[model samples]
Target: MALLEVKNLGISFGGLRAVNNFNIQIQEGELYGLIGPNGAGKTTLFNLLTGVYKPGEGSIFLDGKNITSYKTIDVNKAGIARTFQNIRLFKQLSVLDNVKVGLHNQYHYSTLEGIFRLPRYFQIEKQMNEKAMELLKVFNLDGYSHYKASNLPYGQQRKLEIARALATNPKLLLLDEPAAGMNPNETAELMETIQFVQKEFHMTILLIEHDMKLVAGICEKLTVLNFGEVLISGKTSDVLNDPKVITAYLGE
Candidate 1:
């Protein structure tokens, strides 16, 4: 079965059908791309998938179990995590603390145990910190672990956000424009990091990227959206070369 399947997905706001009749199926460990011109509802689709916004119609299944109406936190616990187009790190917190926030849900200690600073709390906190540090190392941010998140360079800030999301231990990762504001060097490093994540974590990834170079470099397959509807989906080479996709981006 597909790792993620969405059928007849749709949503709207006040008579504007922002997204309609969307459908896709992603296999486990697939690196899939969601691409379209601005305002194509790519982020809206991510929100629906992550439960930031519930779909008005259609069903979402992860590993063959329905998760259509699960709330955001529940969705994360159910194994979906995402990074935003805008960096969403806790700016004032230490980089390590930012990652630890994602690990909070995994703490099994009772509320009283946490409040009283019991042994379980200390044990779990230590484990979480070690795990968070490992994730920072993967993104090459270990050296900045003690710095405030806002103190990192813009590119490092982006990596920290992804590290925080990974700390949730998700099976499916949705990245929204992860390369939005990077220089060429930073973008290159991001491609390598993404490759490392796919190989090391063995996770399914759905990426929304406007940078064709990044998408072309990594995505095995792609789906194109136009006016909130699917224009086409196929192998990366075929989808990018489609005349409809070209026209959608460059105008007829």
Candidate 2:
């Protein structure tokens, strides 16, 4: 069965249909791309998948269990995690602590235990620190683990956000325009990092990216959306070459 599947998904705002009849199946360990023009509801679709918005119709399944309208926290617990197009880190917290936030669901101690620094709290804290560090190292941010999250440069900030999302141990990782503010060098590095995530974690990733080069470089398949509807979906090369897409989206 597909690791992540959406059937007849849709949503609207008053009279505007923001997303309509969307459907897709993403297999485990596959890197999938979602692309479209601005205001094409790409991020809105992510919101629906992550349960930030309850769809007006249809269901979403992860690992074959329905999670259509699960709460955001519940969705994360159910194994879906995502990063925003606009980076959303805990600015005042240490980089390590920012990642620890993601690890919170997996590690636990009672409120009193945490407040009193009981043995269990320290034990769990240690394990979480170790795990958070490992995720930081994957993004090459371990050396700056003590710095405030707001202090990181833009590219590293992007990596930090992805690292935090990965800390959740998700079955499906959703990245919304992760390369949005990157330079060419940074975008190139991001391509490598995405491939690394796929191989090292055997992750299923669905990303919304406007950078065709990045999408073509790492994505195994592609889906195009226009005006909240699917235009086409197929192999990367085929979708990129479709005449309708070229004329309407690529403008080539």
The whole-model lDDT of each prediction reads 0.94, 0.94
Give the per-residue lDDT of model 1 (tens digit) for 1-252.
Answer: 999999999999989999999999999999999999999999999999999998999999999989999999999999999999988889999999999998888767888999999999899989988989999999999999999999999999999988988989999999999999999899999999998999999979999999999999999999999999999999999999999999999999
Which digits, one per residue and each the tens of the lDDT, describe model 2 over residues 12-43? 99999999999999999999999999998999
Per-prediction TM-score to the true structure, in the order listed: 0.97, 0.98
Q: Count the backbone clashes (under 3 Å) in each candidate.
A: 0, 0
- Highest TM-score scorer: 2
* TM-score (C-alpha) between model 2 and the true structure: 0.98
Candidate 2 runs further than 4 Å off: 250-252
